[model samples]
Target: MKKARLWSLLEDGRVQCLVCERRCLIRPGAKGACGNYVNVGGELFHLGYGRLSALESRPIELKPLFHYWPNSTALTFSSYDCNFHCPWCQNYHLSFRMPDISQPVFSPEKLVELAVREGDEGLSASFNEPAVNFDFLVDVAEHASKRGLYFMLVTNGYFTEKALDALLRAGIDGWSISIKGCKGMQKPLGNIDFYVPFRNAKTIKERGGYVEIVYLVVTNTNDYEDCYRWIIEKHVTLLGVDTPLHINRYFPAYAWRKPPTPISKLLEIAEEAKKSGLRYVYIGNLHNPRYETTYCPKCGRPVIVRNNYRVVDWKLEKRDNEWKCKYCGYPVPIKGEYIPEKKWLGLM
Candidate 1:
């Protein structure tokens, strides 16, 4: 544990955690709303700092970031703790309940070294709220940036302005913000404002970082037609219609045991999203072979085809720093090139 950042002390013996939008005022020897911050003798201590809970290599597509670095691998790592307590959380074992197994501390330099050694083009913090490990993320990202590796985050996107600024200032290259439509949902302790995720995504983009939005359509909860339409409109107005939007399927997990999302529902929305003018739309967390592929918005040709997270086909060419479809003159919004198929065959 380290001395936490983005927090301040109180005169009456309480400390406020500014790590998230909740602004949780933690009392002595008590944890914050996120269950990660603690007040230890009038000082705010981050219980999750530098505690490496999981680490692995994955394609950027798995982050659901289809536009930036399509097939490149990123060395992703995350510690314990989250800003939200979603009952439908898939990684409850990692995010909700901190693992009882031993979690070792990894220094910023050590993490950067590992990423360089592993031959990753970038690094990502995922599996939980990356902001909970703010100090570590900033330091490690700064070091990694100097070593020619970029940084990305898969976050719930409910950060305070200070937290968001710290990340953008540290050179976060890309983001995937998950929007859970649980606005005004009651927790045992505090309530949540669901719109904060959109605000966080906007902040990242306004600060000039590439961003994509993911919405898990849960049946009988946030899967209404109007809700999807409103989000699509907002994405067009705020983030741009061309922004990559991932419509992921929800499955039963944790406390909420609803039926798995229907593939028919995914297709229905995919058609709606296309008609809604979203250039890059993907259906994730479930296999819908048709929707998983990226096509040219103008010519209607399949530009990138994938099986699972693996890219099986890429038909893009870079000219004068812009991506163009090889078949037609249509421009692709993707940022990086598809590495040789062989280079992407293995993480090494």
Candidate 2:
């Protein structure tokens, strides 16, 4: 166990964790709602540090970040434990159980070396919650940025402002915040309820970082049109019309056994979001390639064509170090260098 860096002592020897939005206050020898942070002897420590539960090289598309670094592979790493225990969590095993810390330790330097050796375009902190392992992520992301490698975060966006501030300063390139439900849905796992999507979205955009919102449309739970409209009004409206919104179809996973979200419902919600002035919206977990590709909102031309997880064609014209469509003059929402290399193409 490692002493957590983002915590403080409270009155009467209690300890307060400032990692996620929960702001869990714990008494001596008690664990917070996350189950990984414990107040031992008046000091809070992160129990999951250095406990790597999962690591692999995956296509950037699996992260579902089509716009940021399309057609590239990323070295993804994750540790066990998450601040929120969503019933529909896909990776509940790692998120809820304590990770086997006996796995070989890889320092920030070693991780960067692996990413370069594998010809990876970037690094992703995913599979489980990365914010719970903030210490390692911050250090590794800083090193990756210096080497001109992209850094991505697939997070729940429950992080505190302080945690977000540290990551923004560390040069994270992209972040995808999952929006499960509004404030009125059934209580979140662990009985902890609090997620302000609008506030979090605003903060991420203000930092000049790439931000995407993922809303899991669970059947009969949060698939209402009103909730979809609320998300667009609160999160996407202020961020401009170009922000990417992913409407993922939810299936029975982890502890929940609900039926999969219907394709009709997904399309209905996507249509509603577009009418709300959202430029880019995509449907996930289905076999429709048309809904996955990105088009130029200005001219309605297909700028980036995607075949499942692979990017088939890119119609971007580079001038003055910016990407613009060749057909029209509309700007495409992509980042990083588009080097011409066959190795990166095969991994897409």
Candidate 3:
């Protein structure tokens, strides 16, 4: 166990955890909303640190971030417990549980070295809400950067600005934040504003870090057409027109199992988002080669061709230290620090 960096001592032996939006005022000898942070004798402890529930190499495409370093592998890992209890959580087994004895403990440097041994040039905090063990991610990301590996986060975009500031200071190269539009939905995170994620995404882009967004379209939940338009408008006006936003289809899983999002709806939302002057809108989760490929937003020429998860071909040219489409010289917003040489599916 380690002391959390984002906590404060309160009166009468209560420690306030300011990591995610929950901001739990944990009482002494009790865990917070995530069930991982504990107020031990008037001080908060991050019990989830180094206690990994899942670890593996994940495709950047699987993160649905086609614009930022396509086909790059994120040597990713996550810890137990989460800040939010989303009923449709896909990784509830890890996120909604405590650290078991069967789980192995790994230091920050060890994880970076593990990625190096596997020839993976990217490291990510994912599979669970990374806000819980953010300091650990910072240590690993800072160490990984020294070894020429980029760092990123696949997060639920429910963290506070204080945590975001720490992550950027600790060498986070990019982020893939999933934004939920329905603020008043069942069990919505407390004290979180709907516009906070858009604010955070804009800040990341302005600070020279890559930001890709995902909106998981769930049936009869947060899958409204206006949600897509709002996200598109924010992406186009605030982030950039070329900002990559993925409209992902949500499957029935975890607690809220209604039905999978229709593929036609994803296609329709993608089209509407694109028609709103936003480039690089993609339909995710449901497989279709036609929707997976990246085309030049200005010229409409295929720049990166993807089949399922593998990159079939790339038509980007690096000239004067910028990646641009060869067809129209339109700059593609892809920020490729390092591309994985081996197939991640084939064990890179």
Candidate 4:
């Protein structure tokens, strides 16, 4: 356990955690909403620090981050407990429970070394809400940067501005935030302001960090056409049309037993987003080569071809220090260097 960096002591043996928007006011000998923060002697402690529930090296594309660092792998991990109570959380095994201190602790330095040993391009805090592990992530990001590795978050974007600013200062390179729309439908998840995610996305972009939006379209829930339109408008106007937006197909999980999102509906939303002037829109989860491929905005040709979660082909060439379409010379917004030696399935 470690003393929380983003917390304050309150009057009468209480403390307030300022890591996320919840700002849980915890009493002595009590735990906070996420179950990872505890108040001890009028001080807040992060019990989830260095404790991990899941860890693996996975394709960065699987994060649905199509725009930032294509054909790369990240050493991704997550801890237990989440501030939000989403009934259909896909990772409920981790998010719905209290942080298990019994879990093996991996120090920030050890994690960064593991990433290096695994030959990963970066480290990602994912699986469950990462705000609970803010201090740990900051430490890991610092260590990862020294080793020439990037650090990022796959989050719900419910962080306090102070926490976000701290993350940026810690060298966070990118964010793939889930923006679940429909305020009424989100009541199950504590009715968190749906606009906050959009606002945070804009903030990340303005701060010069790579960002991608992932909207999980649950069946009959926040699947309305207007939701897609609103998200498209925000993506186009706030983050710019070139920013990548992922329309993910949601399946039955946890308490929510609704059927999977219709593939046709996802395709329709993607088409509509394209027509709305968004350049990079994709359908995730239910994979098809057509929906996963990244097409050049200018030449209308596939710049990167992904089959499932693997990059099968890369058609962009580095010229003038920018990734440009080989045929049309249209500059693509992909960040990081292309690891040409990295073995790909169907390298073009």
Best by lDDT: 4
Q: How many backbone clashes does candidate 2 have?
A: 0
Clashes of 1: 0
Q: Order the numbered candidates by lDDT, best leading.
A: 4, 1, 2, 3
Candidate 1, after superposition: displacement of residue 24 in Å? 0.5
Query: Stretches of candidate 3 above 4 Å error?
Result: 101-104, 183-192, 338-341, 346-348
Using TM-score, rank the candidates from best to worst.
4, 3, 2, 1
Report the C-alpha displacement of residue 132, candidate 2, in angstroms. 1.2
Residue pairs in candidate 4 whose N, alpha carbon or C atoms collide under 3 angstroms: none
Model 2 Cα lDDT, one tens digit per residue, 275-339: 88888899988867798898888889888877757777788888777788889887887777653
User: Global lDDT for candidate 3?
Assistant: 0.79
158-225 in candidate 4: lDDT tens per residue? 89889898898888978999987745454455457777777888888888898998989878778887
Better of 1 and 4 by TM-score: 4
Q: Least accurate stretch of 10 residues (summed lDDT) in model 4?
A: 339-348
State every prediction's TM-score relative to the real structure: 0.93, 0.93, 0.94, 0.95
Candidate 2's displacement at residue 222, Å, is 0.9
Per-residue accuracy of model 1 over 217-267 as CA lDDT, tens digit each: 886777777767777777777787778889999999988888988878877
TM-score of 4: 0.95
For each candidate, the alpha-carbon lDDT, in order, equals 0.81, 0.80, 0.79, 0.85
Winner on lDDT between 1 and 4 is 4
lDDT per residue, candidate 3, 1-348, as tens digits? 778889889768898898876789988899888877888888888777788877888887777678777788888888887776677889988887876635566899999999899767688888888877776887887898789888888887777789888888788977898887644444433345657777888888888888998888888767676656666677778877777888888988888878899888888888888788777877777687787788897889998888767677888888788888998898887787536444756432
Error of 2 at 65 (Å): 0.8
